[model samples]
Target: MSAPTTHRSAEEIGRTLAGPRPLPPLGATREVPLPEVVTETLPSGLRVLAVHRPGVPMVEMRLRVPFAAPGSVADPAFTARAELLSSAMLTGTATHDRVGIDDELAGVGAELGVAVDPERLLVHGSGLAEGLPTVLDVLADVLTGATYPEPELLRERERLVERISVARAQPRTVAREALQRKRFGDHPIALEMPSGEAVAAVDPGEVRALHAEGVMPRGSTLVLVGELDPAEAIAAVGKVLGGWTGAAQARELGPPPVTAAGPLELVHRPGSVQSQLRLTAPALRRDEEGYAAYQLANLVFGGYFSSRWMENVREDKGYTYGAHSGTEFVPGGAVLGVETDVASDVTAAALLETRYELGRMVAVPPTADEIEAARRYAVGSLLISLDSQGGLASTLAALDAAGLSIDWLRERPVRLEAVTPEQVAEAALEYFAPERFTGVVVGDAEVIGPRLRALGGVE
Candidate 1:
């Protein structure tokens, strides 16, 4: 084996990797305009949005059921019920066995999936236009009449238990879970993982009961069907789901209370060489005033690869591979976050630089050129995000679920274009507060602990 292929020296490797390449000039801008699409809403409260591109023979349907998380009832078993109910939907239904359902979908070249988030359960599927009826039929069966097989439910619960255990082994996942727990406190948003004991303790009856109550069609649903004949699509949905009736009123849960612990939170991970850092506070929802301005500010800071955070933290200082910031806009306001991994030795320096960059943005407004470039980038990116049928369906579904008007698709670009630099600066100053922010670092407790302590007290 040729002496097991001896390893090369670090200096030799470095020399071999040294090469230069051309790069795009700084502050260069590219502008692309997006096509405005039309939207319509049916009498049954189903929203339809379409982009008339004549190529694909497929339609994508996404049905969103709100209240996938716990309501204001404060039931301790709400999380468990939501999880078990969502999982059981995939196992089987009353009319079709698991194998039969899989074979049926494969025969028609259709796909169906269910996803559970903090706010909703989404049932999405796609098929060729000719196969849409069959796909819808299968989806309706699964969503309306899922039978929680006792044996399969037990098996899935075991699998999820093992998966949660595996997630515990990852430092980043553990740290984020911890941060959410501390930040959200008793709110349902903080419940990231369902316990193994809880999953096992949940019975089939509980899952069925939660599904019946929470998955009703009255105030609990928003349907989006894209790239199909609107009349036919709506008729098909109404014909199938009209009989599906329940009277559970949609509970309006208030926004999560604002809580801030400061700029530095250190989660100790033994024997770690680098620190994982997350800095965030509260920010505006998607429908709030200055939402567009907040987005533009984040884009100028860390939303894009060429944004300030990446330029300073990665390209200029070489403290990390990459760094970016983003906001999670739900029913409540939340601040943007800049997340990065840096060497344990330079963790404090990196944190200081991050704070300085944020402060600078607040002090000096972005130039007109920077503001326009950011706007162009944001508009172009949003266009690309809604390019596909499934993408269109998802975007509209999200908007409708959030109670926005159907004209949001046409109004988005105008809103983005009208954002001013002053607005961006003001929004950043109001939202991004380094003093009130929480910074959680997961790394070698022995090394990072001292560094964080020197900078400020780490919580």
Candidate 2:
């Protein structure tokens, strides 16, 4: 074979680099307008917000309850109570048994789902616009008249207990859960996984009590109805939920206390083939002034697949299959995390590289190319999030629950586009501190324990 022809001319290389490149702007200059929505309050103190869209034949309903699992109440009993009450709400009501509820829902072709977050329980459902009244009736019945049958409650409790037991067996789950518990330790937020014993210990009476106390329709509740006439939707909701009365005491579990700076902690699991590394620290809340800047900085670092973390850790070094970082913005300060699983042999190297990348973020501004790509991806992903009825409803409902105004939603694109590279760098410096992070690694203790102790000075 002929030697591969090497056109080793510096002039050719320089010409290639000097070629014209039409680059887009670094940040978005224009704002996308948000939909106009109406808001009102019901006699029962339920806050209702609605957005009217003519073409869709369906309405999305979401009920936001303020009773999120508190960080201070880490006992497995409370954790199990929160989850079981949310699930059992739909299993049966005073008038409709489980079978009846299922048949009625099938008849209307409606779907109901529940989600429990760090700070709230969201009961949401969707149905045809004309069938909203039926759906609402069912929702009201479930919320107001749910009777936690002993047999059904026992079944769900046992099922959840089994699920928790299975989750404990996975290394990734173990590392994440252990890190959360250590970070928040004894706080409600740290109770990410309920113990099987705790799940099994919950009785029907406790489920009913938690439900009655937590799911009150006072200032603590938000009703978001989408793709319907605002007046009509509000009227329907008020009529159905008006009679729902409860003097439930709202639990005043405040936000998680700021974590004290401490040396990294490692959870050693022997016989593990891969090392699961989790590096975490405190970060900005969703509504913080620096949120926009921090978001851009995270994108440049590891929020996206094409981010710096992935490029350096996976593409360049091949130390691990993948690595990424993100921040969860709850009622309290956000939790920032960078996580990955690497072969046991390269666990230490992976940790060093991750720390290097995190430190580099604060030391230097991202290149214009990197900044533009990150902004584009962030804005483009947001636009995609608005493409469906459910997506639109979800976005609106979440924003409403978080107390974000429509104007803020409308201006999100502009804010994202206007973020400068220097702003991202500053955000990184302000929010991320390598020494303050808690590093939890699950692997063979013999292999990683000594290395971690040497690096982190942990005895």
lDDT of 1 by residue, 291-331 (tens): 99988888888888878878999999999999989977555
After TM-score superposition, the amount by which residue 30's alpha carbon in candidate 1 deviates from its true location, in angstroms, is 15
Return the clash pairs for model 2, or none.
Answer: 27-417, 28-417, 70-188, 71-187, 71-188, 71-189, 72-188
Error of 2 at 158 (Å): 2.0
Residue 316 of model 2, lDDT score: 97
- Model 2, 1-459: lDDT tens digits are 888887766656555565844556555547654567788877676778777765668777777777765345666677778887766777888899888887787787787877664567788888887788888888888888999887888888878778778889999988978777757777777776677887777889988988877877775554544557788888888898787766653453457766665666667788888999887888887677878888888888889999988998899999888898898655556788889999988887888888888788877767778878888887888778766667777777667766786677678877887788778788888766577677578888898777777776343
Model 2, residue 301: C-alpha shift (Å): 0.9
Model 2 RMSD in Å is: 6.8
Clashes of each: 8, 7
Name the weakest run of 10 consecutive residues (lDDT summed) in model 1.
27-36
State which candidate has the highest lDDT.
2
List the candidates' TM-scores in order: 0.86, 0.89
In the order shown, what is each candidate's alpha-carbon RMSD? 9.0, 6.8
Q: Which pairs of residues collide in model 1?
A: 262-437, 265-439, 281-335, 282-334, 282-335, 283-333, 283-334, 283-335
State the lDDT at 322 in candidate 2. Answer: 87
